[model samples]
Every structure is written in structure tokens, then in C-alpha cells.
Target: MCNSNSLSPVWRELKRLQSTDELFEILSPQSFKWNIGKGTQILFWYDIWVGVSKLRDQFPALFRLSGKKNEHIADMVIFSENGLMWWDIGILFPLNEYEDLQYQMLMSLLRNFKVDLYKEDEVQWTHSLEKVSSVAEGVRVMVKSHIDFEFDRVKVVWNKLVPSKISTFHWLAIQGGIPVKEVLSYRNCLNNSSDDKCAWCLDHIESIDHILLHYSWSHKVWTGLFKWWNIFWVVPSNVLEFSVDWSNGMGIKAEKVWKLIGSATFWAIWLARNEVIFNGSYTCWAVIVSRIKLKVFQWLVNAKVCESFQLYVWSDHPWLLLQSPSFDMF
Candidate 1:
């Protein structure tokens, strides 16, 4: 076991891998580098200390002739009596013309490089602003590299106005992974076809679209929101289409509030559905509309969108509240 007490924060994190029973896999080397300090802990040839690549890869022929192949960076430096630093890379054999040229190029590259003898070597994650290695940063780097397409729908799904749970629900809903009755039936969780009826209406199959959008109960919820915004909108076939169309129709001034309201509307309807199914609560669209308004008003106040926002004004005439001078900053 490595002594964690002696290691830097980054190395200490890396050391935890040794305790795992599974075969250790190396992460992408290009995403990491050593921030050379004293350089005592970093391998001169093998580690990415000097540049974007390791010295061994950059000068393979010179590395083959090096006597101290496994030497640390500290071992390659020689200090004169006056404290001038000089590189004394131990070359095992005489250099040909091409090898001598490589040697001169290597020396030139190291001429301006300075190492602090007092400071300890540190590992840096190239992708993060802090240059510190972390699981989250590593995952982000890896995911970003692999993703080739533009995922603009994620911007619509993950709204900063709502909690992560709400955003997560939206994400799942977009992917058709939400446990609506139809999905449950498909997964063999619901044995009876009768159990797949819409929880709100019980007239149509409880699909993601029906329960959340097209059904009379949920449709009224959307209609109430549109009436509040005073905009004519044709509800799309599905959640993703609805989000795209709604977003496209928003004006610059009302865009932020509109997005927040849209997210709140979906969440409110879902909550109402759960309550009706699980708690045997009342299935009134009017009550759910009131809840959506209250939810959005509270979110605006909590987010400090406007200090003087009145709920009564928002409930009666949300358009006027949005048009108020207080919201001009938005």
C-alpha cells in the first residue's frame, strides 16, 4: 500500500485505485500531465512533464540511447557552483549526425524550462480549470470526447429554474423511459391490460404522451398555461415536440420566464398524476392549474427574479407580472 500521507491530493486520489480488486485500466494519457515543480516524483522520459507529450515518445531514438531511462527529472539536472542549472542527460552511446541534431533540439527545448527545487511535483487534469484530478471532471472529459453529435434537447430538459429531480424526470420523459402504465406493461410489471388505462382520464392508454400531453386532463393544464401567457399554441404529438415548439415561439423578453413556466407545468401535471394514482386525490385540472401558478410564483420569488412579485397579480394576470418593470432586468 502507498503512503497517502506523503502524496499530493491528486496522487492520493490515484492511490485509491490500488485497493480495488478489478483489473486497473489506464485513463487517457492525453487528458493528464505532470505540473513539474522539483520534478523528483516525475519520470523524465515517461511522464508528460515538459510538453503535451512524453519525452520518450517525442525523441524515441534519443530515449533508446539514454542510460538513465527510468530516471526522475531531478536526476537529469546538474547545478553549477554559482547555482546555474544544466541538463546532464546520461547518453549511453556516441551520437550520429541525426542523433546529435536531436540532442541539440532536446537541449533547446529544456533551456527555458525552470524547476522549483523547493516545491513538490503535482498531477494536473487538463480538462478542468483548477487542473486537479477528479472523477466528475474525468467523466466529463471522457463523455465530451466521445459525443460527436449536437444534443440541443438537453438544454430544454435541464432547466436551472427547477430542481434536479424535476429536470431528471424531464430527461427520462424525453427518452420514453418514464414508468407510465404503458411502459410498465411493456416491462411485464403490469399484468392486466386494464391497468394501462390513463390514471387521470382512464379513457385512453397511459402513455408518456397521453398522460402528460394529449389527454383531456393534462391538455387543460397546458391550455391554462397558454391562456395565462395569452398565446395560441397547438399541443404537439409528444413531450419533445411540445418543448421544441414552445421554445421556438418564445420572445426574447419572455423566453426565460416561459421556459421556467413550461418546466413547472410538466412537473405540476406529473405530481398531480402521482397524487391521483397513489393517494386517490381529486383529479381536477383547475386545482392543478392553480398549483402550477403557485409553483412558478414561488420559484420566481426564491430565485430572486423579482423582489416585489405579487402572487395574486401573477395568478390573475401573469403576462402583466412578466411585463412589470421589475422583470426588465431579465
Candidate 2:
């Protein structure tokens, strides 16, 4: 009855959209609920129609014993000659004492439920009185549920000295929205790649933290920067924590320039990663460190963060700009 080549354009687009994880995560129990009618369209066990959680999660023992794991709600209900509705759940084996107790609980939960066999099921938006879903509503729910970062990172990433693109990248990186190998794997987009290993190290999975913070190449770049500032440093677990740690450690006078340098360091390491992966050209960590220093110097001079200073002085004694009373303009 159906062929992929003969699918309507809208239907094809819908199919493509269904494969994305964003839709899957957004349509969770917190934001959306099913208004049961006939229940023919809803999965009986896997869907969150019966209660706050999925039936499989709520009745794990019963779910494990179920033979008809993929049965629909309508299929699990039997209609008697007297117009009585009864469960027809297909269990593979008899329940033990604990599972029998769970079964009793499940039956009690479903005792007062009624199903209308004639009407179709509908998805209702939990957040709205109208029961209609909108992208704005979905985004609001997602942000409220998911975001748990400190507000200080926002100010750090949006520094006047950093380029807008780099600032945006840092923001995305902090949110785990960057399309690194680990993220692409999570989105099921890394079909061609054998594994999500770091391009530079080829040892660990290439998460944002591994590539930008933990890997030897990126670690060396951070170490070089710390040595340049003559500060003892311990790397944090992830980008956001690193930003907060770095900010908290810096003095009031050094914070602005240090934030700029931090942003430049992340950008340079990312560029080096892309160079290896896309251009098939490899640059060492020492070169990446040099690039970060040069790029930060350029950003400072162009942004007029302070009076123009010689590149040699920046490369050799960069902390002088932060420590010197004459360069207090920063």
C-alpha cells in the first residue's frame, strides 16, 4: 500500500524529522501527554499513557514476563459479550510473590480507567491550557528542565575582545551543542566513521571535554598558556567548569584579558582539530599554543582592549599586560 518513492513531500519531510533526537527529547512526559481514546494508536507498555512514567518502567517485573511486548493498548483489552472490558496481557511465565504484588498494584492503578473504542487518541501539551503545542513552549520547557550552568559563563563567553563566532562556539560548547564526534554519535550521525576517537590522539572518545580540555594536545596548549601567565593550574572536568574555575582564580585586574585569552585558546585548539580532520594537515600543540597567543594579541589590539603592544612582548612576557601598572587600561 505504501512506497518510499511515491511518498508525499510533506510525508517525506516528516519522516526525516522523526529521525532527529531533538523531537524525541522534546516530546517527553514533562511537556506532552496522550489523551487516551480508543488507545489503538498508542503502545501499551512503552508509552507514557497510563501514568507519569511508561508502563515498562513502572512495572519492570511484569514487562520482563510479557510475551507481547509490542502489543497496542487496544490489543491488550478484551471485549466480552456482556460489554465488559478485561485485560488480555500475554505473559510468558507465572509471576513470583514480588511480581504478583506488583501486578496487584498495576491492576489497582488501572481499576477506574475507561477506554472509548470509537474515538482516536490525541497528544496534548501539558504546559498549555489549550492543549496545543508550539515550538516556543517546547523550548521553554526544555530550557527550564535542562539548563543547570552558572550565569557567570555567559559573561565570560560574550567578552568584547573575543570574536562573535568564537563566542557563539564557546556558548554552544558549554551547552554540549557542538557537533563533535561524541555529539554526532549521540545524534546517530557518525555512520561512516569507525569510532568517535579523537583525531589527534586516536585513543579516547572525542567528546568536547576530551578534545578541548583532556586530550594531550589540548592539555599542552592549556599548560603553555598557564606557564605564560606563570600560574599553577589544574584542569577542570569540562568546558563550563574550566571557565568558572579560571574566572574564580583570576584577580579583578586580570579577569578581562584572561577571559579573552581563554576564549582564544579554545578557538585555536578547535581550528587545529579541524585542520587535521578536514584539510588532512596536522599541526602540533606547540604551534596551537603559538596561534592562541598570536590570535589573542590580535583580538586585544583590534578590539582596543588596551594600547597596542608589540607581538614579541606579548609572545614572551604576556602576563606583563595583566600585571604592569602602566598597562592597567585592561
Candidate 3:
């Protein structure tokens, strides 16, 4: 009898401050005196206030029509509609993005027909409790898994649960409406797009392959490394082939050369495209080759490296193979 049970779990202690009955006004409506404690909860008591009859209808699951019936009702908190259970805080919150997630999850749980799965005529409330607990745990897991990839891409992305870390090249590829595989395919199918001439030949218009490896400029850029490292390679023409065989079948020096060459070629091509578009200037082959040479030389200096790598470099970019004429020992 919540009517007489004005022992509001929230605000009953303050009423004890005064002992006199005159301090409060008791307006009896069928049952339970009201207008107590400065008219607090009077409106709530007037509106949604139910005295057994309405409570039975509104929340039949909690209260059966006939107390002796011992049968479940429509508002049974024990019923699991999908995994959506009575314990879900999702039930009590406003519908927002996160709430939408809850809603969808609940709908999915309902769609699973999990409520009917249990043969027990006696309702089980475990689904509600378990679903809520599971969802809460998943949310925490996902949030903990989120990361900002500014520091170390490989370490950050491949830590444990997260692994799909992207790079600048990936970004550019996205901008071009292409994927990594497509870019590799373009590498292999570097056929002349213009006339009968080969783009790489500089004697003819270019294709993707010409731009990557076969062009006269690219050939020169790679020649130095090839001669130095003695890498024997069969050029590929698609993303899949290149990704698989780009650095395979090569000695340590040859592998290093392939890595450097691939990087230089991709970098040079991207730069050349930008130069052509933004500066309206055609990059000379000699300039491209020289840039590759200078970059390899500088890298060798900085790395103090004299070992093999997994990526590719051109043979002509033999800055690594050549002994440093002078080493500044500090």
C-alpha cells in the first residue's frame, strides 16, 4: 500500500524533523493521506499515482490481476524479447545514438525468438540480466580498444584486438577511389594509355607499367642498383602478383634494391603527378633519377645500415652497396 507507504525511499528522513501533525496536511483520496511535506510529490501522486487497480494493469508482469493466479502478465520483466531483459538500463534512457544501438540489439534479440526458446512455463529473467551485462561489457571493450594512430602505426594498430591501421598511401588510394590491390594491378598493367608508344620509354606515351618500372627514366634509376646488387627480377603487372612476388626470389642486397626502387618509383610518380598538375612542369627523367640517387645516399648515411631489408630498391641506387669513401667518426 504505497499510498500509506509515504515512506518515499528518497525523502522520508526530512519529515521526521517535525513531530507535530499540524505541520502537514493530509488529503485522503480513497486511501493514503496526501499534501504531506510542503506539497512535495503531490502532482506525481495525482497523475501517475496508482492504488493497486491501475498498477496491476500498467505493470501486469510485476503484479498479477488476481494475486492468487500465479500466472505471468504482459509486462513481465522476466520475459526476454531477444536478449533485451528487464535489467537493461537501455529501457530507462532517452533514444539517442547509443540508445539506437540498444534498440537494435533488443530488436535483434527479440528476432532471435529467444523468449520462446525456453520450455519452462515459468518465466526466466536471466536473458534480461545477461544481455544487459554483456552489452555493458562489450561497450567497455570497444571503447578501450579505440586508439589514435599518431604515434606508432604498426605498434598501435597491431597491439592485440585492433589491426587495421592505415597509412598516407592508403589515404591517397582512398582519395583516388582505388584500393591497395587496384594500385598494384595498375602497377602490373602499366600499358600505354595514349597511342602505340610506351609511356616508360619516354620515346612513347606512358602506361602504368612504364611509369613504375619500364620507362627509360625508371630503367636508369633502377640500373645503378641492379648492377650493384645483381638482382634478377621478373617484373609483375598486377596488385596480387606484385604483393606476393614483389620482394621474393631475391638475395638480401637484391631485396633491399627492390624496396628502395619501389618506394622511389611510387614516391617519384606521385610527386611527378602533383608537379604536372600543380606546377604545369614536366619532370625530367635525369632529375627523377638524381633525386632517387640522392635520397638513397642520404638514407644510407642516416641509417648507418649495411644489411638487407624486406622491401625493394632499384639496382642503380647502390648507395648501400658502395663503401662510404669517408666516415665522420664523432
Candidate 4:
């Protein structure tokens, strides 16, 4: 009960309460501050070293740590008129490195200003924001934390874009069952000089577009499907052009079909290419069409995939539905 002890009894209460939980009052949405500007009110969870001069001259009760070879046990060292003083700051935390460290550095930048569709946030929204770049990065990080996602499909593309190699999308694609090999090969498709030809159609080297869009076989599959659906058949020549030129001119049905067309078609063609190379076999165009139809229908059926099947629909043709990964789409 003597007032001789350095902390005015109240600080001791705070230190003791920390044994139970964090020093701040735990409110639902945010932490609460009970006092400020007063001698007792403090948001800091740890001690603030008042420096040697202030401690020795102002408060005779507080003790100092030995500053031997900078190996002092105190949490922090302070310089004052008397020279130096060491005081315990708080509990030391663990460490973070690399991308985690970069992320933290990036998050710190959010303090500047971030604009979403129509919203704004300040830098100190959370100290944790210090661990990310923009608010968008923060959101993506939170999403990664809450949900399990991988980026196997786009791994190659993303890795090429990411220096120091921290790939969020690559992980997501992997989790989505996207073939990493394809992602790696997708780059080859982007470069025209590469001999990477369509594995399904040996007549042309496989590039991403060649496999997905312009291959002789892929063209036939899509073209035939479009004709069946009574829609215009306008296939872009390469991935870049396709991205720029894709249209839903065939109406609502075409839009739905287009969504699934690329994925389903590519999946089908890739599977066939494997069959030819590994199995040493090839199917006629008519057989290929039937197989594709069967595959799409199975996917549709199994997905119980009703109204939104259009998300998978392309070219407005039931024929487009046939070209899926496996015959399981029914």
C-alpha cells in the first residue's frame, strides 16, 4: 500500500488484468478506451520507458536494468539527460518474414486512402492493415483466411507475374482442380514462337488459344455446335483476340453457353489429346461430338445444375453441352 512503488497502483492493476486477457476492454465491434489525458488512461498494452533522466530525477521508486553490451533484458532502452535507462516495455511477440512481411508492409500503405465501388477507409482502421497494401489486398487476404482456395489452374501465369513468388491465385487455381501443367503450358500459348502446339491437333503447335479456340478439331467442335443452335459462328484466332472479340450475339442462350464453352471444350480437347498420345488412339469427328455431348449432359445432370446451366452453355447449342471434362456431367 506504500506509494513508494513506481507504478501508482493502477498500472499494476492493468498488468495483472492482462494475465486474464488483453488490457483493453473487449467490446463487440471494437475495443473501448476508459480513460485518456488522465494520469491513468492508456491505450498501450505495454510499459513505456520514460528514459533514464526522467525515471531517476522524477520517480525514485522505479529501477533500471543493467545495459551490459546492449544485452539488456528490458523491452526498450531510452536516452535521457543522465545517459541511458532501460525499462521493460511489454511481452515480446513472435516473428514474420518474406511475403507475410511484405504483406504487412503492403497493408501499412492502406493508411493513405483506398476507394472501392463507392466506399472509403482510413489507415488505422486496424493496426493489422499495416500488414497489407490496399483495402483490396486486405479483403483478398481475409477471404483467403476464411475460405480454402488454391490456384493450380493459373499458377504458371500468376507466378510469372509475381516476383519473389507469392501466388494467391495460383493456390486458388490448384484448389479448384485446375491442372498446373496447363497453366504452365498456358504461357507457351501466349508466346507465338514456341513450338507448343495443340496436343489434340498435331497439325498445329499447341498454344493456349490453339487448344481452346483455333485448333482444327476445336474449331470443328465449336462450329458444329454453333450451327446446331442456329447461332453465328465467329471464333477468335488466339487467346488475346478471343478475349477482346468474344460476343454474346446469339442472345441469352449464347451467353450461358459461352461461359462453359471454353472450360468444357478445353477440358474435352485436352482429354482427347491425352487419349491419342497415351492411348495411341483417335476418334472420328462424329464420335468425338457424341462423346462431348455425353460429357456435357452428365455434368449438367450431376450438377443438378438447373437454371444456371447457361453459365456452362455456349453457342446456344445442345451440342456445346456435350463437350465437358467427363461423361459425368449428365
Task: Give candidate 2's TM-score.
Answer: 0.55
Q: List, residue by residue over 31-77, the lDDT tens digit for candidate 1.
A: 45677789787778766767677897799778767766666789999
- The window of 10 residues in a row where model 1 has the poorest summed lDDT is 17-26
Best by TM-score: 2
Best of the two (2, 3) by lDDT = 2
Measured over all alpha carbons after superposition, the RMSD of each candidate to the real structure, in angstroms, is 21.2, 10.9, 26.1, 22.1
Query: What are the runs in model 3 whose C-alpha is more than 4 Å off?
Result: 1-167, 170-210, 213-232, 252-257, 306-330
Local distance difference test, candidate 1: 0.72
- By how many angstroms RMSD does model 4 differ from the true structure? 22.1
Please give the range of 10 consecutive residues that has the lowest summed lDDT in model 3: 155-164
Q: Tell me the spans in candidate 1 whose CA falls farther than 4 Å from its real position.
A: 1-148, 249-253
Q: Candidate 1 vs candidate 4: which has greater lDDT?
A: 1
Q: Over the stretch 1-330, how does candidate 4's per-residue lDDT look in tens digits? A: 101133335433432332122222221112111111212212111112222122222221111111221121122334358654333322134334543463344235323322222332111212134532243543454465553323223422232212222234223322322332334433233332222334565455344555556767767877766665666757755443343233333453344334343444445666676677679877665566556555545545555643344534532445444454432333
lDDT, model 2: 0.71
TM-score, cand. 1: 0.53
Question: Relative to the unseen true structure, what is the Cα RMSD of model 2?
Answer: 10.9
| Deviation of model 2 at 250, angstroms | 3.6
Alpha carbon deviation, residue 290, candidate 3 (Å): 2.1
Show the lowest summed lDDT stretch of 10 residues, model 2.
Answer: 1-10
